[model samples]
Target chain A: MPGNPAVPVAGNRFCIVGGASLVGSATAGELLDHGAAEVVLFDNFAFGSDAAIAHLKDHPRLRLVRGDVMRMANLLRATEGMAGVLQLAAYMTLSMDRDPWGGLDVNIRGVQNALEACRANKVQKVVFASSNAVYGYGPGVSGDLVEGTPFHSVGAPPAAILYGASKIIGEQLCRDAFRKWGQDYVILRYSTVYGERQHYRAANALYIIETYDAVRRGEAPKVFGDGSETKHFVYVGDLARANRMAFESQATDVAVNTSGPAPITTLELVRLVTELAGGGPEPIFVGNEPGKVRLTSGGAFRIAHEEAFRAIGWTPEVDMKEGLRRLIAWRESNEGRAAA
Target chain B: MPGNPAVPVAGNRFCIVGGASLVGSATAGELLDHGAAEVVLFDNFAFGSDAAIAHLKDHPRLRLVRGDVMRMANLLRATEGMAGVLQLAAYMTLSMDRDPWGGLDVNIRGVQNALEACRANKVQKVVFASSNAVYGYGPGVSGDLVEGTPFHSVGAPPAAILYGASKIIGEQLCRDAFRKWGQDYVILRYSTVYGERQHYRAANALYIIETYDAVRRGEAPKVFGDGSETKHFVYVGDLARANRMAFESQATDVAVNTSGPAPITTLELVRLVTELAGGGPEPIFVGNEPGKVRLTSGGAFRIAHEEAFRAIGWTPEVDMKEGLRRLIAWRESNEGRAAA
Candidate 1:
C-alpha cells in the first residue's frame, strides 16, 4: 500500500491548516474523539479566533501551531509527520472584496504552501476544502450542480468571482500535486458550512445567524430579494465527518460536493431560524443591502452530494432543522455567549 | 479636461507592464508611432527576452525598465507621470501548468501591483490584457463567445482553469479599482494573438509556428487529434491598436473581445502555414502529445469582437493568412533568426 492513499483516523496524526475556526475545530474534535493520536490545529488567527477553538483548547491529543501559510517554512514545519492534512484557510467573498490582496495571498498562496508542505512531509492523505462556489454564482448557476458543472462566472461581482476563482485554483493545485508527485488528495466542495462555532464570515451562512439574531432582538428577519433564492449548506459537523471520511476512505484525486440533505429557500431558512429561536415577528422581504456582496444564485439550485457518497462513502447526517437546533442551542450556551 | 478618463496618444506618456514580450513590443511600437511622449517598457524578462524587443531597443521615445510586477515599489516608480498603463504581464496555461506558484504570483498579485501603481501615480487609464480564455475551454466553450459568456472550466486541465481564473481575477481587480477610486480601465479579452515576435509561449498559437517551422524544415507538420479544433487569433498589431484605442476612447469600466476577422480550424491553419512555408508533406494526424498540456475545445468556437468595435471603435484589421505571413516573415528575418 505504498501509494494507496487511505489513512484511518484511529491512532493517526492529523493537521488542519486553517484550524481554530468552525469546521477546523469541529473536524479536530471529531478526529480526536475517533482516537487520533495527535491533531495539530495550525492557524494564524487572522480570521480565526481563539473563541472558536476554546472548547477543545486543553485536549491532551490536540496541539495548536501559530503560523502563516504565506511562509513556506511555517508549512514545512507544521505538516511534519502528519498522516492527513485538511486545508481550510481562505477568504470568503465578503472578505475577498474588502482586501483582495490579503485574500489572494491567503487563498492561492496559502493552498499552494499547504500542498507543498504535504508533499514535503509525505503526508498520507489530504482532504482539501473546496467550495461549491466553484460552480460559480449568478444566473447561469442552477439545477443539480454535479462535479462536472462548469464554473459559471458571468454576471457575478469581482470579489465573488475572485473567491470562486481562488477556490478553483486551489482545487486544481491539489489535482496538480496529485498528478505531479502522486500526492493523494480529495477536494470536498462544501456548500456554505453552518453549525456550532459558526463565525459570521461566509456570505451565505451569515444569513442564518443574522436571522436568528434579528428574531432574538424582536425584529423582523429580513430576506433579500424574493427569498426564493436557494441556499444549500452543509452542517459543520457533517462536513467534519466528510473530511474525515475523505482521508479514511480509498478515494483519491477526486472532488465531490458535501452539501446538506436538501436545499432551503431564504424564506424557509429565515422561518426555521425564527422558529428555532422561539418564534418572532413576521419576516420582511427587502431589496439587497447597498454595498453588501451577496451571493445570488439565479434560480433554485441543489448541490448534489451524491458524488461525495460515491467518492468517499459519506453522506450528510445533519438536516438543516436538526443542525439549526444544535446551532441555536450552542448560541444559548455559555461558550457561544462568551464568544459573542 | 480635468478628470476626463481619455488620454490622447499624441503626447501622453504610457507604461506597459511586462512590456518586453510580443504584444508589449507591438503596442510600444504603436504608441511611439502615434507620437507618444514616452513609452516605458517595464519587464523582468522572466518569460520575456531581449530578442522579442530587439527591433525597437534603440527607439528614443521607448525606455526599457527592468522591474518585477510583484514589487509594488518598482511599479510605483515605473508608473510615475504616466498617462496610461497597459498590463501585459501574465502566464499562459503551459507555463502555469509547469510552475503554478510563479504563474499565480505574476498573474494575480502582479495585476494588483500594476493597479496600485496606476492608482498611486493618478494614471488616467489602464488597458488590461485579459484573454478569451475567460470563456474557458472544453465542450462548454463553443459558439459565439461574447463578454457575457459564462466561464466554462469543466473537463479542462488545472493549469488552464488557473490561467483563466487568474485573468478573471485581473479583470475584476480592474473593475474593483474603478469602483473604489474611479480608476478608468478597459479590459481587452484578446483571443489567441499571433504575428511578428511570436514566442514559444501560448499553447494555442504555438500550432501555427510549429507547423510553419516543420514545413520549412521539409518535415510533415504534426496536428493533434483531427485538427478540427477552433482557433480564433487576433494579430498582435491589431491587439496593440485595440490597446491604444482603449486608452484613447472615452470607454471606461468596460470589457470587450478583440478577436481576428474569423476563426480557423486547426487543419486549415496547418495547411495555410505549410503553404506559407513553401508547401511540404500533408499534416500527419496524431494523438495528443504525451505530457503536453493541449487546450482542446470540443466544438468550433468563434470569439466575437463586435463589442470591441462598439466599445472602443476597434476591430481586427489583419486576417489570419496575412498575420501568419507576417509571423513567418519575422521568423525568416535576422532578429528572428538570432532569437531562434
Candidate 2:
C-alpha cells in the first residue's frame, strides 16, 4: 500500500456499518488483517448473520453493535469513535426485486442512516459498495462502465429490473452524502462477487452455489437463460482488498470498477465450475425466456479495473478458475459441508 | 381535458400521503375538483396547517388520516382503503437544509414508509411530487433542465444543498417503488410554485411574501444575489392542475417537468412585483455571492407543461403576472392589515 501517507492507517479506529453481512464482514476482516486497532461492526442484523459475529468474536479489536440502519441514534452509537466507515449495508439483487418495499427501506433508508451517522461522527473517509447494476443492461463496452456512464435505469428498449433501480438509488445516496457533508467517500461499483461466506442462500446466488453443488454431486448445473449472457465475477477476497485500498487512498470523488479482468458467459462459468470441481457434472442450458434472460444478462459486465489498480495498487490475485477451485474445496470442507 | 379515454381513471378511493402541505393539499384539492369519488388526507402534520385541514374538514367525500410518513404502521393504516396515492409528504427546502438529520429521516425514511404503504395497500397509481432541484444548476438555458440531463447532484461538483440531496433521494425512492412493485407512478418534478394557500409563513414562500410586503411598504426589496441568475416559478395552481393531469392520464414510467413558460430572473421578478404592487420600492442588488447564484432554469418544466397540455389539453390559466397579482391582492385583503 505505497500511496499518500495521509490515508488513515488500519490500526486506527474504523467502523463497518452493516458489518455483520458477508461484504461488510469481509471488509472488517481485511481491515483487521491489515492491523486495524479497532473494527466496530455496526449492523441492524436485518439479513445479518450470527455466525459472522461468532467468527470474529475472538478478535480482540472487533466489537459488534447490534443496531438498525433505519435508526440514526443506533448508527451514531455504533459509529462513535470510528475514524472511517465501510458502508456495505444494502438490499441487492433478487431481494429487492421480490420485495421492493423492503428493498427501499433497507437500501435507501439504511444508507441514509449510515450517512447521517457519518456526518454526526465526522468520520474521515467512507468506502461505499455500489453495484454495476446501476448501469442496467444497456449498450456495449464503453470503457467498462466507468464512473461517468449515463445511468439508464430503463434497460434497452423493453425490460428493466428492480435491482437496478435500487442500486441506482444507492449510488445517488452516496453522491448526495458526499455532496452534502464533503465526507470523503470511495464508491466501488462491484461486479458480481462470488466466494466463500457469500450469501449463497439468496435467490440469485442460490443459483450460483446450487450450480456449484450440483456439479459437485455429478448433476447438471441449471442455468435459467441461454449461456451466451455474460457476467464479470470477482472473487470476494479481491473485493475485500479493494475496500482496504479505498481506505488507504486519498482520491476524492473516486469511483472505481471493482471487477475481474475477463467477462465470462454463464455457459463458460458452468463449464469452469465443473472443471474446477474435478469432472462432476455437465452444463445444462435452459431456453431463452424473458424473466431468465432479463436476470442473466443481455449486456456484458466488463469494467476497467485500472482506476482501482492504479489508485491502490490493487489487482486480482485469484483468477476465476483458481478461485472456483478454492471455493469448491472450501465447500467440501467442514464448515462448507455444514453450510451445504 | 381530452386525451385517450382508454387511459384508466384513478381508482375510486384516492389518498394523498402528505395531504396537508402546499403540494399535497393542492393536489388533494385538484383530485376532488376532478371528480375523485373519495379523497383521504394522510399527514403527520409536522409542517401541516390546522387551517388547511379545517378548510377540507367538512368536504363530503374527504377523510383525514392523521399520521406520519416515517411510521410504517401509521402509513399502513392510512393507506388501508386508498386505491391511488399522491405521495407529497416530505421535509421541504428550509427544513432539510436547517435540520439535515431530520431531513434524511423524513425525506428518505418517510418515502420508504409511503412506498411500503402503497405496496401493502395495493394502491393502483402513485403520483410523486419530485423536484427539479435534483438537477443542480448546470450550464444550459436557466429553464432548460430536461428529464434526461445527467442528474449530477449539486453535491457532486459545486456542492449539493441538503434540500437537493433529499429530493434526489425522493426521486430514487419513487423509481425504486415503481420498479419493485410494478406500481404505476407519475413523478412530477415541479419548479418553484407560488399560489393560493401556500404556507406564507413557511421559510421558502415566507421570504417571497415578506419581500413583497417590504416592497409594498415602500422599502427596497433586497436581492441576495446578483439578480442575473433566474428560477422558473410555476404557479401552485398550475402545479395542482399538473398533478390532476398525471392522475387523469395514467402515464407510467414517466417523470415530467411542471414549470411555467420560462424563467424570471430575481431582478426581473422584483421589478414585476414592484409594478404589480403599484408604486412600490426599487430593487437592491447584492453582490454575486455563493448562495446568491442558487437557481435552476432547466427546460424540463416547460417540457412537462407541454406534455401535460398534450395529454390533458391543460394549460396554465394564470400567467406569472396575474398570479403575483392574485397573491398580493389576497395577502392585502386578509393578512396585510393585521401583519402590518
Q: What is the C-alpha lDDT of each candidate?
A: 0.91, 0.68
**On residues A143-176, what C-alpha lDDT tens digit does candidate 1 reach at each position?**
9999888878777888998898899889989989
lDDT of 2 by residue, A1-340 (tens): 3223235655688888778876777788888988998998887677788765567867999888888787888888888877778888777655554555566667766776787787888777777888776555544333456655544432332223345544555555666576666777788888778777766534444556878778766788876556767767788888888888888876756667788767777788888877777776567777744553244444555666777777667777777887777777767877677755
Clashing pairs in 1: none
- lDDT of model number 2: 0.68
**Cα lDDT for residue A1, model 2?**
31
lDDT of 1 by residue, B146-248 (tens): 8888888778888999899899889989999999999999999989888888988999888777888789889999988888988898999998999999999
If scored against the real structure, what TM-score would every candidate get?
A: 0.98, 0.75
* Residue-level lDDT tens digits of model 2 in B1-340: 2222122334467888778776776777777776777888887788787665566778898888888877888888888866677888777655654555576677767876787788887776777887766654444333445665434332232223345545655666666666555777777887777766657533435656767878867899877556765656778878887777776674766776787766666677788878888867667876634642234343322333565566445566777788888777766765434433
What is the fraction of true interface contacts found in candidate 2? 0.06
